[model samples]
Target: MSRQASRRARSIALFLVVTMVASCGTLPRSGPNKREIFAGSVLQEGDAFVVSVNPRVTAATAVVPALGFSSVFRDAGELGADTIRPGDTLGLIIYENVEDGLLTSTGASASLIDEVQVDSSGFIFIPYAGRLRAADSTPEQLRRLITRRLDEQTPDPQVVVRRLAGDGATVSIVGGAGAQGVYPIERPTRTLSAMIAAAGGFSIAPEIALVTVTRGNRSETAYLSDLYKNPHMDIALRNGDRIFIEEDTRAFTVLGATGTQNRLEFETETLSAIEALAQVGGLNANVANPTGVFVFRNEPEEIARAVMGRDDLIGTQRLVYVLDLTRPNGMFDARDFVIRDGDTVYVTEAPIVGWNRSVAAIFGSLGQVTAAGSAVGIN
Candidate 1:
């Protein structure tokens, strides 16, 4: 090889040797090893199940359940509009045979009633029917009451009642909508999704939304996207129901040698390890140790016990989950791993990289020495 090419070959050889030596550096001192948390094969069937944050760990197969808030929707059912109340407007039409009625002066033999607001006493005054009770009465029931009373004075009476300018039930919506206000609940079974759509939908994708529903003294919350995935979560809306859509405020912290180290919000409630990494701009390829991608969480005692193979474990233990992207199966594990709120994703720096830098520094020193020798030899 030429002189310059020969020096380049030697530098390459030194870099490789230093990298190998650094790879075998001493292990960090720590407490006794817990159960072999280092996993390789897929968790088989009948293995001790240790999972949380959307839970998919299983021995044979991973089965994840829908959000717990789905049950709140189930219990809500539908709101009814069968009963009338005060502040309701009613339209009435009365027709009577003037020839048979002494009270009629043959005016028009018909009466056109504009609109009558129901009084707080649950009564509306009709010309011939006198004061009729309309509150808490369905349209059919009120029509019959007017017909029965009119018949007593006139030979033949016809009466019609129509609801004018009032709604039976309504719900209130607030936050991130084109129009945030109270909206009518017209359908017998108005779902949470329907209400949101009617109110002009959300500014962002529903999957990235956190929705809260308040009814009476109880308030429940769920991800807007989860409601779409599991239909059961699209709960029935009731009268006086208040719904609010919050931003995708859930975030996790990223540390160590990732591309970007900071707290990042989730685009959606459900995320895998790979997605979390992508959120933080993935690992720092040049500096990160792919084998040391760890997701740290303070697991509930039950889950820690199961995964740690310790029945005696309490619910407050912290856990470190390792994912080696350097291995073929590492990506698969990452894909299946779920990330929860407040988790910390850390990527370690590759040790071999440090040693490689040292090799470069040594070569740099040699070049300076050789350049000085060349000047002296020339003199």
Candidate 2:
């Protein structure tokens, strides 16, 4: 061959060899791979946040109280009964008797008045009387005030005031509860358990459920676990109070070549990839491929555009991080990778996965064809 032609051919051959080597997919031996690893540092048992609950106030303590009370009585004596504020409907019953010369005559009267709507001025209007301050008075207190006013107008006036409608009373139960609804606190008696029973009891698993109380804009979260651990956590329901049962918000699923394949739930706010793997009872000893672990995440494109400065291809923006588990240094990188909600982790087996499937298919086909030929020969 000519020298120039030989040189060109050699260069082409070298390029082809390099391309083939690259296509063969060699394992990373040195330097950090751009892919993120899913591993977390081992946290000791005491390392987690532990709030020491007093036994006196825990659910164990509250159990006696819960058992002592009936559902009916608990529903009746709740917080709404004790306080009467403005904007309450009052039912008035008045009895009057008049005596004539020979025979005595008596008359009974009952009336459902329009709501004694307490004005912003903190005054309520009665039928015969003008506006009276009733902003902080209970139903019984309001009754005495109305009676005094009537007595001033006449002698021995009989008056009874019963609160027909309480101040705007509603309790919101959310999260893990059997029913999530806004229940009206219509009467004086409404207990926490009663409210829960009214809306439906705790339906979620105790470990994963959380109850939050929000009054006005103030919010407080209570672990349902704590409710069992401490009785004091259960508070009386107040007007405009909200009860929220939060679902198991922290959880991840591990699948493929794992000892156990199932969705794992966590109570902690954050979980690393390694922690998620551990929760799934660790990887399968025989089938797990140490070098081919992958975490598939549906990342929003906006995040990539901001952080990685990558091209925002509308549909293709989602990223898949393929991690190598064989390297010891990869463990630290995996620790840094935080598990997000609905994240799926797939630990793949070796390339023999495809070969095994192919072999199984070939055997099955051979058996079927052999059977068909025998039937044809018989025919």
Q: Name the top TM-score candidate.
A: 1
Q: State the number of backbone clashes in model 2.
A: 19
Backbone N/Cα/C clashes per model: 6, 19
TM values, all candidates: 0.69, 0.49
lDDT of 2 by residue, 14-79 (tens): 455446545766532221222222222012222111111122212211111011222322233245
Q: Judge candidate 2 at residue 250 and give its lDDT.
A: 61
Tens digit per residue, CA lDDT, model 1, 1-379: 3677656755665565556546866333221121233332125332233232222342212222233464655777565464555667788777777654533446566676867988877789987678988987887899888888888888778777887754545788898775799987765338888888888888877667778898888887877886778788888887678998878776788887777778888776677889989887888778787877777677677666666666886557666677777676778778778777888887776767655656665566556555654565521
Model 2 Cα shift for residue 61 (angstroms):
31
Clashing pairs in 1: 44-59, 44-60, 45-59, 45-60, 301-314, 301-315
What stretches of model 1 exceed 4 Å from their correct place? 1-72, 75-86, 97-106, 119-137, 149-156, 187-189, 226-232, 356-379
> Which one is best on lDDT?
1
